[model samples]
Target: MTLRGTVRTSYEVLTSRFGPPTFPQVDDGGLPAEDSTLWLIDTPAGRVHVHNWLDVTYFLKRPAAETRWSIQATDDAALPWIYKSVTGSTAAFSAGVHEFSRYSTRVSLARGYVTYLVQRMIALRERGERYDQGSREHRHQIELSRHVGHMALQVQQIVHDVEWAYADDADRRRWTTLPMPQLADEPESQHWHRWTRWTYRPVPTDSRPEGGDPDLVGMLRRRARDQVRFRDRILPANHRGPTREGKVELYDEHIGTLLTLADTALPDTVEQSRS
Candidate 1:
């Protein structure tokens, strides 16, 4: 059979759906099994062979649940069928947002999940350090840490699918579900100059969105009115550096900060960055 495609997924991900491998290596077999495990998936396209070919060498390095085995299939049309069978998604590869929730929904859920995963990882590290080396407690923590990391990657994979998740341009354009953003607890005067300080007003959260679609038109109006004080009442000043070289030098020195600010300020839309 000709190798048509490969599915880069973990053993658990495959076995949970396709059941255990039809041909797993002998339990007490000697090391270096060329085909460690083989799953014969009967897809609608045809029967395909999904196996960890020559993975015995590297499989032990990572947890079996997280290790990405290059599962191969021979049928020319088996890849799509395999994907459809596993995910139970009948839609075509180019399916649109009707097949899923809005992009903001997944993104917000991902944000919360990633945050929790990070906290779990940190706690695992701290707790693991307290145990003695080679002890069962330490080993258990190590296993838990690895699983937490694997979970983070899984969340990343799900949330990165933005094209099929987003509704449209109107649905894509959104805020963080709340008009009144959380502040840094301290007064803005400490960090901002007199100019930007006035723009940082404490708005009432009663009008903010609870969870679902927000009144973006109203939010924009309020945002502009509250933040664009310099254009209306305040007399703004424009000062240019003496030489182009000086401005360029300052920018070069702070390029990292500028790039970070740009990244946070201008996020890419699903349409703009669908790969």
Candidate 2:
């Protein structure tokens, strides 16, 4: 299939709307050899084909697909629009680069997201006064802040599950007690550094650095909760914006980062009922 634009989203997101995909030999308890985990859907423009592409190496590691799947269509001829129509996922229509199998834990994924959100929030603060209420820029401001609140909620309720998976509080603390990653002037670069170190101390390894300062779990959690309160203070003045006309722009800003993070802790992916 000719690689077109990609939608990095959850398997459940796909299956919820399209039913189970072409799960070839799923009952055999064997890893799929070909691109067997596939989906086909009809849209006004054309049929959309969704698959795992070349990310098969990790399939055995997970009998289930990743919390997200990078869908590369067979054609780009108005297919991006069709994809948005069918899957309701954020899509970018360009023959994008192929994605590889990436490994990430729930805690690391959430931590990386926290890094991106805080840094992005700082950037937004620098320009918040510039955005007029009910304007396009205002929408960005509202959405970003609201999502921060949403993320903080995710951290306390969902990311905590990952922490609890360990045998004891020390081990749990070890998972979240990471080191700061070096920040960048650019968002993507900063996100990569934050997530890649994902573990900066020898929680198991020390890979990325953020000025070498230790990242305390309790402090980070408190910081995120503070953002939730901050959003509430500002939300009364902000709405999703007059309409949904250009709301997906944040996807451009944050979606790619999300797929990169692949925070399985996110509840969006596990919504499927296997039974």
Candidate 3:
């Protein structure tokens, strides 16, 4: 196929030689695998894929509304995961405000782990421990410690804001639904997940949405509000039953200076491998 056109690239010579194109084939894995000699590229909204030559012209001619929907779906799915994590935490134990409190406990553990690591690294440096040739261990420890500290601060701020999750009856009166955000996926070790939080507020009869739309909106708002209230009123109040305590076992731990060596030596090892 002869390629032509700059911003608007075309390959019309293919049709002149091969007649018209057949349907694109789906790969064994069920993915659309275009086999055309020349494919039109698309990177809009991070959709890095090739399209059949015909699709390029078709997409260009499609209505803006269709393109807007496509863009929204791609961009919406690409948002960061951290927001999902905490929001999901609340949703898992629907109607249990205590569940949110429990999430605060996990946050505390993350904060403490970060603090302990930072202190341990600092103590190692103060004791004149050996550093790698590039001193990457020292630098990495510092950078990780800083990042952990920042996350801790942000979590602390969010947790301290009582209004973010709690509302008095007066405050609740303003809305139809409560937000019940849930994690989109399991957290990565201790990383965040992406989630959506929905909060509903009451609309006056005069200001309510038009005809059928208002009814649909009202239903959604009520569902959201009920879920939020369920979390707040149900989860935490029912905690003291049998108090099933599990047996605790402790194992002797090792003081591995080995990790320190690996952490220090790894970069050099990778460099050697490349050489």
Candidate 4:
């Protein structure tokens, strides 16, 4: 079969196994090559993109249009898991049927575990305990910490996306109600601040509803600030020593705060964290 025809057949099989999708699949147009087909499925929790490119197919799920908790699978090896995630059954596949819900739960647990390790590392540093620059343990810790931090960032992004997706109208309005700012005649530097200023102009306090939760905007702003801080401070000091030590605390703090905010905003994340 043609690649596009194969993808459509796979999607049909999934729908038949899992019932109909939340909404009808729509053609999302193709790339410049015109050798691919892209279809979008809008679900209650998020959107799925089915991309058929040459001999390979990719299924990508994004919650609330956010890259967090996004899942992508390519080829037959990954198709079973995607199907199981949707159908909550592995009857269609003889083997290798993994569920997205379980995957999300495992990610959450790993994120928590990594946060604990970071805390311990901070405490060790606080107590003046030092590890040799070339020590195996020190290098391992640094590598593992970096990986965990990256994973946690993904999870937090997903949680925030879900929270934003399901937030009350008032909370949602905080984002939607803002007026878009016009770009200056001469755009400023490529820094995030410039992007933020261009994308999200602050709303007047008087315009917000009385007693409305301002935490939504605050969280978004903090996330942006932390991102800049991470890019500027932590990324540059990728080594073991006083330079990294000086920046580690702030990095951990930013990540920790993000995790806390995500968890607080979406306490029942595992239940609806599928992407």
Each model's total of backbone clashes: 0, 5, 18, 0
Regions of model 2 farther than 4 Å from truth: 1-106, 131-140, 167-243, 246-275
- TM-score head-to-head 1 vs 4, winner: 1
lDDT score, candidate 3: 0.28
RMSD of 2: 14.9
Q: Which regions of candidate 1 are displaced past 4 Å?
A: 27-35, 54-74, 87-275
Name the best candidate (by TM-score).
Answer: 2
| C-alpha TM-scores of all predictions | 0.28, 0.29, 0.20, 0.23
* lDDT for position 129 in model 2: 52
Give, for candidate 1, the lowest lDDT window spanning 10 residues.
90-99
Whole-structure CA lDDT of model 1? 0.41
User: What is candidate 3's lDDT per residue for 1-275, written digit by digit as tens?
Assistant: 11111111123432332334333555798744663323222221122121234443343244221221010112211111111121221111112111122222222322222233333334434433345536656554444344334433333333222222344466544432544555445432222211211422223344433111212223323433443454345335445422111000000000111111112212111123344
> Which pairs, if any, clash in model 2?
180-210, 181-209, 181-210, 182-209, 182-210
Better of 2 and 4 by TM-score: 2
Sorted on lDDT, best first, the list reads 2, 1, 4, 3
For each candidate, what is the lDDT? 0.41, 0.44, 0.28, 0.39
Which candidate model has the greater lDDT, 2 or 4?
2
Off by over 4 Å in 3: 1-78, 81-134, 137-145, 163-275
